[model samples]
Target chain A: MIDWALVARTLPEYWVGLRVSLLLLFVSCATAFLVSIPLAMARVSRHAWLSWPVWAFTYVVRGTPLLVQLFMVYFGLAQFEVVRESAAWPMLRSAWFCAWLTFAINSTAYTTEIFAGALKNTPNGELEAARSLGLSATQVYRRILWPGALRRALPQYGNEVVMMMHATAIASTVTLVELTRVARDVYYNYLAPVEAFGVVATFYFALTYAMVGAFKLVEKRYLRHLAPRETGPAAGRPT
Target chain B: MLKKLALAAVALAAFMVQADAQQTRLRVGVEGNYPPFSQISPSGQISGFDIDIANAVCAELKMECQLVQQEFDGMIPALAARRFDIIVASLTITPARLERVDFSAPYYDVPSQFVARNGAFQSHSPDALRGKRIIVLRNSPRAAWLQQNYPQNELHLANRETDVYLELVAGRGDIAFGSSVVSTEQFLKRPEGAGYGRVGEPVRLQGGTGGVGIAVRKGDTETLAKVNQALAAIRSNGVYRQIMARYFDYDISPSN
Candidate 1:
């Protein structure tokens, strides 16, 4: 048995943390999506120099642990004079900004791989047909190539977004007040791991489950065209 | 045939003895992020003030020590679930904690203090908060103090002491509250705390000085007593002072 009052009291703390965690998730996901498209294009290019830079960037970001990357960007970069003098320092000076940057860059590596695979699966015939239509290179990418590739990458991209939602848990390490951070505050009251963590576990379970639900909603919307129009099994549920 | 049977019996006994030796190992849990206290070295080996003391504690108990790395917030939960036997990660002994588990004799005593980059640190009462916000480590005694004293001000709670320092520097809020032991390294660098200042005269002037002790599962009285004896031996043998020097400059001796 546990005290419901204590658990109720802890909910607000977790909510505050949850909000920050979601904020981090949104910021990182948007950045990673923007970065991945260009990096994937470069990776698919014939030019060695341009593609190789993207390769090295992806390799280094992937090779290191997220904790080390957070430390390096937050504490390590603060050491350099050039970064200090640059306009980027305004963003870097913030722990939240630095954490968001780390999450974005880290996800970019994984997302780049996903985008590259999707790009590879882009039909050669469609590409040729797109070319015959006299579509400009950028137009071809915008209209045909990107949409098709993105459809192939949706399932994977969805997973990344969900994982990022949970990965926001680590932001607490660098000083972001996410769900895990609030768990610690609850611990102060109960001092009992079982009592405090019981609430925390529920918060995380709710959060992770909510993320799962949201991802599914996104998946359904993206794949709705594939869904049977007539006599589909129980089409929509009321909120 | 008789000789062969006798030799087999002796071999079985030797194997049993070897198995018995391995079960006597002591498992230690640590966060491994709080450097100079508990951290993972570049070589992947766990080493720090707590590690050294844990080793000494194990030696005194006549058991081999095994170090396990866990997040600070999850350490106690893991222990409750029997993931490990003891926590030596500068865990402050508190009443709220005692309800769920038990603690050994105090090993290190350090006062909980606050630092502010803003002009002189201010507080109307233990409960009062004007315009200034105090950042505190999540899941620590400072959070306990805030929750008990100023429940409304939690909206301004900073997750970690480091975050508090950064927030103070960024002018997000005003003060950062933590223990002397945790802030000693930063304050000593400033000498007069020239850049930063301490808040209030210091509360919990007696038992509230932030004494850290090892936490063990409830009902593990034997282990608790053994740990207390080991801690006392470390103090008497001067090993405590040596371990204290690695992470702290001040003499934060626990009153026996």
Candidate 2:
């Protein structure tokens, strides 16, 4: 039932689409990493004025569908006369910039919540120990709190990254020609949903596995001390 | 920040009011990206041949026309969901589509033609374009025709009619197939299209059933009859020809 010849002939096109998908994934994830840190801090802050706005942002963003958010950014914003007349129109008019901004902002909301939840759960004993040792609040956060929270948040954050990769498929609605778009085009031309979607399914499956594998490596390195003592034949062999 | 908040609040209230007031107006669905047919202008207003036709029909029927922007592929589903009363997009009548919804008499008919760079292809025959990269609009009759007749050719399906020409110009494909009016008026007459020209005779489907029509929900005889009457009224009056002249130099009526 597989059309290997069709797959071979169209692999190059799919590869180009894969590159675009990866570009969107990596760029948006990197930007989300940068933005979510401060947002997460504000989310857990003592000041209601500071925390409420960030809370509202995450609540609204996370509550709405990403596709609606994307359309609001890419198409709805352009519907305004003021937006078109503004200097940012040049940048906002580009599909790549719009997709990147939408993905990054959407991922930031979810990541911020993950990081905030981890931050709130930091052990009280750790904070007491740091204060008793005379570490200033800044130093304590920099050295102990941030590191511990980040390490705890890593697994959830990794899932967010994978989810963002899947979310990149929606960029095709604005004409980015990513992996799902390529598969759809091929399906349209060939009228073979089975073969076309099979290829896309395989690509996404492999990508998800690779992401999970990378996260596993990270967990091994960073959370090694948390692992139970190795008791297998090869346990005592490694450094 | 305060001004922006107030503006957003007002916009939200306006949307709520509009949603509540939908019963009295006629909601017409249109794919606003297809130039020369139905396009959203820079001012965010819908324009072009299909928009004008829809407006004229609404006027003839004495109903208020509120055009709703929709993607072509989702037009039928949206209609079934009652998001719109009728689809006035440049939707061609096809047997497969007739299974889902009913179509009024064709408002206009245009031939499908192939476009390529100068001297790229001699003809659109299966033998001539066997190994060529061909681009066609997704879910279009032209795409169906290509797949049925020239399955060996490398086919690239574009989401929009404009993208078909873009793929040809970008060297991703050797030829593109779409509405002759769009390829000629929207692309070939422009400066960027100087190197491209029509490569073959217009393609006619096996059943000779290619014509653009307005679609309504299946078994909605009252709306369908009203739409047909409006279409006939416009054709007899000079409104249809006047709208046609704004977009096309040659005749696009069914006879031509």
Return the top candidate by TM-score.
Answer: 1
Q: Which stretches of candidate 2 lie over 4 Å from their true place?
A: A231-239, B1-108, B111-256
Q: Taking chain A by itself, what TM-score does each prediction score?
A: 0.86, 0.95
TM-score of each: 0.64, 0.56
lDDT tens digits, residues B18-74, model 2? Answer: 864753467899998878897787899889899999999999988889999998756
Candidate 2 per-residue lDDT over residues A143-184, each given as its tens digit:
988999999998999999999998899998876889999898
**List of clashing residue pairs for candidate 1:** A184-B139
lDDT of 1 by residue, A162-189 (tens): 7777788778776676777677656655
Candidate 1, residues B80-156: lDDT per residue as tens digits? 88788899898878777777778988887767666765356464354545545667766566676666666666434
> Local error of candidate 1 at A73, Å?
1.4
Q: What's the residue-level lDDT of B27 in candidate 2?
A: 87
Indicate the residue-level lDDT of B119 in model 1.
53
Q: Could you give the CAPRI-style class of model 2?
A: incorrect
